[model samples]
Target chain A: MRIAVVGAGPAGVYSAQELVDAGLSVDVFDKVPAPYGLVRYGVAPDHPKTKRIALALGRTLGNPAVRFFGNVAYGLDLDLRDLLACYHAVVFAVGADDDRLLDVAGEHLWGVGSAAQLVSWYNAHPHADDSFAHTVLAAREVAVVGAGNVALDVARMLVGGPHRLAASDVPERVLDLLARSRVTDVRVIARRGPAQAKFTVPELTELGKLDDVDVVVDPADLAGADDEADSRRARANVELLRGWAERPTGRAARRVHLSFRLRPVAVVGETAVAGLRLDRLGVPSTVPAQAVVRAIGYRGAPLPGVPFDEETGTVRNLGGRVVDATGTVLPRLYVAGWIKRGPSGVIGTNKADAAETVRALLADADGFPAPLKVGPATVPALLRGRGVRFVTWPGWLRLDAYEVALGRSGGRPRVSVDDLATMLAVTRAGDL
Target chain B: MTFVVTSRCVGTKETSCMSVCPVDCIHDIGEQVVIDPVECVDCGACVDVCPVDAIVHEGEADDPSVVADAYRRFGLEAP
Candidate 1:
C-alpha cells in the first residue's frame, strides 16, 4: 500500500518509519525546503542534545521505500481530495505553527513578541523577521511570560553573555545581534506556582549553568513546589529552586528571576512595551521592561481540508483517526503529533502516537478498495502539471550539503539559509 | 530489574533519559545510549522517558539477538 505523510517533523518521520518497516511505500511532504520541523526551527540554538534527533529522522527520510517532497504546502499546493486519490492513506503530522496569545491590553505594542518569533529569529527559520533582532537588542530588561521550557529557553537566550552562543548553530548575524543585546534582567512570570509549572525538571535546573548569571528564585514560591509537589520531577524542581533561592546574589551582572503566582494583566505602553503589569493574587503591580515575550503555549491552526478543533487547537481525532464535530470518523485520513493531540509531550511521545495511528490505518486496510492512481510518477506528474516548484529528496540533500559547507568555513556545525530564494537557487545549481 | 538500553535506541539517541539518570549510568558512546549495569540503580527513570520504548528489564528481553547486538555496540558482553 502507498501512504502520504504530510509535514516532515518528528511525527511524520516516525509514522513514515513504521510504514516503511511494514514494507509499504511512503511519500513525505513538508512546506519548508528542509525537514525536521521544530527541531531545526523552534528548539533553542544552544540545545545541541535535543536537536541530535534529526540524525535518526534524516535516515528515515533517506530510506529506499520513502520519498521526500519539500516546498509543497498542504491546502495550497494540494488539498485532501487530491491526496486521497493517489495514496491508500494520508497522515497529517503538521505541528502547532502559531503562538497562543496572552490577550493582554498592550500586546499590540512594538516590543511585545511571542517565543515563536524569537525562536524563529535565533534559529534562522525562513519565517523569522529581521525586526525581532532590533527589539531584543534594544531592550534593557525583558519579561518572558510563561513557565514551560519555551519560557526558560527565551530567558536563557536573553541573559546569555557575548561569548555564550559562539559555538551554537545560530546564524552569525543573529549571534552578533544577541552579543550586542542590552537585556540584563529577565523575569519568567507564571500564573500558577512552581509545582504546577509545565517545565521539566532538567530544563528548569539547566538555567543555573549560565555563566555568572544570578538564578533568582523567591523563597516563598519554593514552598508550593515543596508542599504540593506531586511527581518526582516536581520534587526535584523544588530542590533545585530552593538551592537557587538560598544562593548569594549580586555576584553577577545578569539576573533571571523565577517568579511564581503572578499573572500578566497588560503589556502597558502606548506604542511599545514599556512594562508588564501583573496581578499577584489580587495585588496589583507592574514589572518595568522594554520587551515582553509571551511563551504561554503553542496553538495549532486548521489545515486545508482537515477537521480541526478550534477550542482545543488540535485536529479532531479519536486516537489518530480524524473525526468531525459530531464524532463521525473520516475514512482514509489520520493525524499525529501536536496536530493529533494538543501541543504537549516530548519528542519521543510522537513515536507512540504515530504507532497507534498507523495501527488503526493498517487494521482498516483489510477492507480497502484497489487504488486507481498509484505509482512513483503519479504525484510528481500531477504536481509538475500544475507549476509547483516541489523539491525532491536529492534536491534537499544538495541544499543540506551547501548549508554544511557554508558552516564549515566557520567552526560552527551548520549555518541555516533562512530565505527560500537562496535555498532554491542552491538546490537548483546542483541540478538535482 | 535493571533497565537495558536496546536496539530501538540505535538511531534516536535522545538525551531525555540520560540527563535524568540519578546514577549517571547512561552513556552515549557512539550509536546509542548504554546503561552500565554495574552502576545502574535500576530506578526505572530511563524507561519512563525513552521515546521509542527501547529500555527493558533484564528478564523482559525476549529477543536475545537484539539485546546481544545492543550490548556489543556498547562493548559489553551479553549475559
Candidate 2:
C-alpha cells in the first residue's frame, strides 16, 4: 500500500512513519526545502534544548520506506483532486501558521507584532521579513498579550541576556538585533487571574531564574485567585507566581512583569505603538510600551477543496477521518495535528495523535479503491513535468551539513539559512 | 545510585532538577547542566522535575554515550 502525507512537520512525518511501520510506502511533502516544520521554525531559538526533539523526528524520516518531497506546495503545485487520483489515500497534516489577531484599535500599527512572527524572526523562517529585526531592536519596552507558553516565550526572548541567545540556532540578523536591543521592560499581560494562566510550570519558573532579569508578580493579583484545578501543574504555577511576588526588587538591568487580570482594551498610538490601554476591574489604565506583541494563538487556513470549520480553525474531521459540510466522511481523506485539532500541545504530543489517525486509516483500508498504477516514481515524474524543483532526503542532509559548518567556527549549533533561495542552493549543493 | 543529564538539557537549563536534587549533585556547566554521579544520592528528585524528560537513571538513558558524555562534561567518572 502507498500513502501520501501533506506536510513534513511532526504530525505529517509521524503519521507517515506509523503507516510505513504498518507495511506501507509513505511519501511526505513540504512547502519548504527542509523538513521538521515547527521544530525548525516555530520554536524559540534560545530554547535549543526543546528543539533537540527534532533529532528523534529526523530518525523517523530516515526510514527506507519513507520518501521526502520538499519545496513542493500542496495547493499551489498539486491540489487535493490530483492527490486522490494518484494515491490510495492522502493525509493532510499542514499545521496552523497564521497568528490569531487582537482585533482591537490600532492593532495594525507599525510597532504591533505577533509572538509567532518574533519566533520566526529569531529562527530565520524564510517567510519572516528581515526588517522585523530592526523593529525589535528599536523597542525600549514591549507588551506581550496572552497568558500561555507562547507569551512566556516572548517575554523570555525579549529580556533574554545576550549570552543566552548567542549560542543557539538564531540567525545573524536576529543576533545583530539582540546586540543592539534597548529593551528594558517586558510586561506579560493576562486577561484572567493567576490561577487561570495557561503557562506551564517549568516555563514560568525558568523566568524567575533568568540571570539578569527580575520576575515581578503583583501580590494583589494572587488575592482571591485560587488555583481552580487539582493537578500538580496548576499548583506549581501558582507557587511559582507567589515565589516571584516575594522576590525583593533588585538592580537587574531588565525586568519582566507577570501581570494578570488585565485585558487590553486598545493599543494606544496614532502611527506606531507608544503605549497600551488596559481594563483592570473595569478601570482603564494606560501603560507605556514601545512594542506590542499578541501571543493569543494560531488559526489554520483551509486547504483547497477541503472542508474547514472557521470557528475552530481546523479541518473538519472525526477520529482522524475528514468529514464534509454535510457531516459525511470524505473517503480516503484524513487529517492530524494542529490542522486536525487546533494549535496545542508540544512536539511529542503529535506522536500519539498521528498513531490514532493511522489506526483509523488502517481500519478503513479495504474501502479505499486500489491505487492507480502510478507508483513512487510517478509523482516525481509528474512534478518534474511541471517544472518543479523538489528536494529529496539526501538534498536536505546536504543543507543540514552546510548549516552545521556555518556555526562550527562560532562555537554554536547550526546557523539557520533564512532565505529560500540560499536554502534551495544549499540543498542542491554536491558532495554532502 | 547515579543521575545523568542528556542532550535535551543543553539549551534548556530547566533547573527544576537542581532545586529538587537532595544532595546538590546537579551542577550548571556553561553550555549544559550536569549531575555529579559520585555526589548523587539517587533520590530520584531530579528525574521528576526535568521538563524535557532529559534526566534518566544511570542505565535507562536512550543513548548510553549520552550518560558518559554528561559525566565527562562535568569531569566525573561514568557511574
On DockQ, the candidate that comes out on top is 1
What do the candidate models score in CA lDDT, each in turn? 0.83, 0.82
Query: What digit string (tens of lDDT, one per residue) describes model 2 on residues A336-402?
Result: 8999999986665677788889999999999999866577778888788787778889999988999
DockQ each: 0.08, 0.06
Give lDDT: candidate 2, residue A68: 87
Clash counts per candidate, in order, are 0, 0
C-alpha positional error of residue A295 in candidate 2 after TM-score superposition, expressed in Å: 0.2
Worst 10 residues of 2 chain A by lDDT: A224-233
| Candidate 1 backbone collisions, by pair | none
Compose the digit string of candidate 1's lDDT tens values, residues A48-150.
6556667768889999899998888899888888899899989999999888999988889899888888888888887678787688668988899998999
Model 2, residue A17: displacement in angstroms? 1.2
Measured by TM-score, the strongest candidate is 1
B1-79: candidate 2 lDDT, tens digit per residue: 4778887887888786765453346788776788877666554556656788777777767888987876776676675
Model 2 residue A281 CA deviation in Å: 2.7
Q: Please identify model 1 stretches exceeding 4 Å from their true place.
A: A429-432, B1-73, B76-79
